[model samples]
Target chain A: TQLLEQSPQFLSIQEGENLTVYCNSSSVFSSLQWYRQEPGEGPVLLVTVVTGGEVKKLKRLTFQFGDARKDSSLHITAAQTGDTGLYLCAGADSNYQLIWGAGTKLIIKP
Target chain B: GAGVSQSPSNKVTEKGKDVELRCDPISGHTALYWYRQSLGQGLEFLIYFQGNSAPDKSGLPSDRFSAERTGGSVSTLTIQRTQQEDSAVYLCASSLFFMQGILSVGELFFGEGSRLTVL
Candidate 1:
């Protein structure tokens, strides 16, 4: 019953590599959000996309919302060791209830 | 508090015991959500409280798990007869919601989480 499907549930890469994680769903969402979490800490919001086909960039990280609003992607360029952590995506339904995706655990090797 | 606050950052209890976890959301944030996370896994929704409306408890795993948000502010998650399977980090998050549901699709501030370990 997981409405949001995130790909590459686990990823391990060396520093300086580029990577992309995806979150897809069959249902359209009003808004999509991405978060990054470190061990023993809460997930912190990275970006939120509302308008369909909108693209947002945060530093070296790029976030894109699907034109249909049913999917999203997060891309990181030149990954750093500091980028290692769990990446999560959440989509807000029409009722404003958020459906979370299975997280992607990323490990950046130095 | 400036951010969401959760009590008992870590808790360890024997099986079949009862436990309570508290959450204090940012003042004025009326939308509160509780989630559980197992080691490196995705979050499991527990419950959510919006304004004065009845909470959505559809995600509660069992009758042993219950939560209450009082006066649209603080919240408490109680687990009666805790089991080892209940061990996980309980996360509390708060968001600001306006008149419409669309406005509710905003940022969610989260607490550090309360880690519960049942033997």
Candidate 2:
């Protein structure tokens, strides 16, 4: 089974702090996606990166796909309380299935 | 619906009982997927349906778990003799289509999910 290991399973920071969450795997992926989920809701896609060394920024969140396509990272700049949630990373396997990471729970204190 | 829809947002059932979760994908989406999420864990793929092709059941944990998508629109996931381990959020998602080539990636639209609690 393909596994995506995410780092810093739990994170807590004050407002305006910056945080980064990383997802690593031994298997290379064709594409990687980042999602943020709130309580009582399914995850919402934040961004998708397809190429190696790709970077996409959405508002305060920036996502980077590793040069080897075996890892990805999400960086939040000037984090706000609204940025608090579970951040997940998913990669597309050869079978077109999404292999997901355990995710990082982020709490931004206001 | 504009987005994927799941029924019985929350369900509390006995350990030996059976439960069925429903998923209604967005109109015109051809790819549907089922996943289970335990507390503090990532999404675990359960089943996948694409168009009229054979459904992928490889991810189903056991024979007790089965799912079916009818007429290419709505799908149902059934768990028989539910166990405490089956308690989790059942999520359904749909994409316009499955990834076709090396570079194409389908973006999945997810529902609010059905939270099942087995006692």
Candidate 3:
């Protein structure tokens, strides 16, 4: 079983639309990280939230860590075709190792 | 400086054969990690090396899989008697430090993974 679960395994939306992807887990985390992976490449870090209830914004993308430290969410505003890719959230478990979610595949149609 | 670099960008081997994948971490980094990504799946942790101490091999899947980091720099992951299910992209990452208790959560720099195919 996956320690972290991501909602909406796949998302397809029109350009200019907004979307939010959720990552939930039963275990608390010391830090949660978000990454984006494109075709033929490894995942690139987008953001890392260490504090609970922390909110970080990177241009049109916003990431929020749950107050309980067991969940996180990614919100994209005015999504564009360039934003299409696989979004992954990973949390540092009790062992201080990363536990990953299945991932949310986002596709923005023109 | 350059990020992590992996060798044999793509490899193909028949079942029951052996394969080796290499990873060169960033300079001066004390931590290195190996992860495997299969089709339609998330990145699975394989192993981690910290400084010159013992590596964290808890994530290794089976006895057929093994890895070693030499001189605290380059790492090689070897899979003996590979199976078709082992086909996947193997990724390598490195960080400034691997300390967990000290809260040195350094961001990992990942290489463009090496794709392995077992037929």
- Candidate 1 on A1-110: residue-level lDDT in tens? 53999989999999999999999999999899999999999999999999899999999999999999999999999999999999999999988799999899999999
TM-score, cand. 2 vs. native: 0.96
Residue-wise C-alpha lDDT for candidate 3, range B25-110, written one tens digit per residue:
99999989999998756889999998887899989999999999999999999999999999999999998765556655578889
- Error (Å) of candidate 1 at residue B23 is 0.4
Writing each residue's lDDT as its tens digit, candidate 1 over B1-119 gives: 69899999999999999999999999998899999999999899999999999999999999999999888899999999999999999999999888663365768898999999999
lDDT score at residue A5, model 1, on the 0-100 scale: 93
Give the candidate number with the greatest DockQ: 1
The candidate 1 chain B region of ten consecutive residues with least summed lDDT is B97-106
Model 2 segments beyond 4 Å from truth? B98-103
Q: Decide which is better by DockQ, 1 or 3.
A: 1
Using Cα atoms, each model's DockQ against the true complex is 0.81, 0.75, 0.68
Ordered from best to worst TM-score, the candidate numbers read 1, 2, 3
- List candidate 1 segments past 4 Å from native: B100-102
**Residue A83 displacement in candidate 3 (angstroms):** 0.9
Superior candidate under lDDT, 1 versus 2: 1
TM-score of each: 0.97, 0.96, 0.95
Candidate 3's docking class is medium
